[model samples]
Target: MYKAACLVLALFAVALAVPSTYDTEHVWKAGNLSYVVPDNAVLGGFDPYGFNTYVGRVIYANSILPARVVVETGVAYFNTETLSSKLLVYDILVAERNVNYVWVRSFDGFYEKGAVAVGTTNKNERVFCCRAKTDGGVLIGTLLLSQKLCIIKHETLALRKFDKYEVLVAQAKGNGTLY
Candidate 1:
């Protein structure tokens, strides 16, 4: 019982403290994991460095400067078996630029190359999926997904969307891709 009490207290502390600020409502509901976003955030269109660093709930496009566009991401699943995650980054200049959203199979495995397995498309688009191997191991580095306009972007328990703002389109949507 003491261990259970400690665990509950730890969870409470994290809930009260993890959200350092109130840019957005720092929500985690119904299996959707999101970082908090500011209400009046301005998602600029720029990403010089390739990694996403969060300033509160929204990701910072650049460490020195704030995000050109306020963004959030989360993972989803059908149940307790199948699983996937996407990093839905967005921008204001382009509405949703550099959208590096992808879905993948949750597993306890290793892969040398990325899992950008989107093939059989005869469209004219450029995509580059690379990796960043630092001390943290390999990470999804480059992003290159079909630039299809998601005209009817909606927020669902299964889809990642911008918090506090009703967005129309996204940058990318992948089923699975490893950096």
Candidate 2:
């Protein structure tokens, strides 16, 4: 009888200790330029280091907001098969508040790069999103786990500054497959 009473109390205690909040649905991914278009994603084709030439864009439902992204993958080692790689860059989407930050990642992310050259970019990085005279600013962020056969770097953007120049960390994704 006493053990039964204790078990009931333990159950009641657990019920009270548990916080009432929904944490399961908040998991999200770091916005990749890949998310820009639903069906128009350009697979792969471009110079590994060419800046604007490898870029892409997506016009969202808002109609007024134009989104742009880019992906690049190649071997800089220019070495033999063992040392070759796939480079990538593109528009990284982030959920933002208002227009100031077209996107800001308010939730937590299980960020995993589909791939990277030197391995994972989980290393913290300084991301600078800038522009000329229009709505412009910079961002401070980091790169995380990159695991995929094809290592690629993708960057997404929607800038007010047309002629401004910015430098970002060059990351790559590649295939470790042997054919």
The 0-to-1 C-alpha lDDT of every candidate, in the order given, reads 0.25, 0.24
**Can you give the lDDT of residue 51 in candidate 1?**
30
TM-score, every prediction: 0.17, 0.18
Please report the candidate that would top lDDT against the real structure: 1
Query: Which portions of model 2 miss their true places by more than 4 Å?
Result: 1-68, 71-91, 102-127, 131-179
The local distance difference test score of model 2 is 0.24
Error at 54, model 2, angstroms: 11
lDDT of 1 by residue, 1-179 (tens): 99999999999887654322211211211112354444432222222234332211122211111111224333211111112223343221121233343323221122224332211112322222222233232222222233221111112323221111111112243533323
lDDT for model 1, please.
0.25
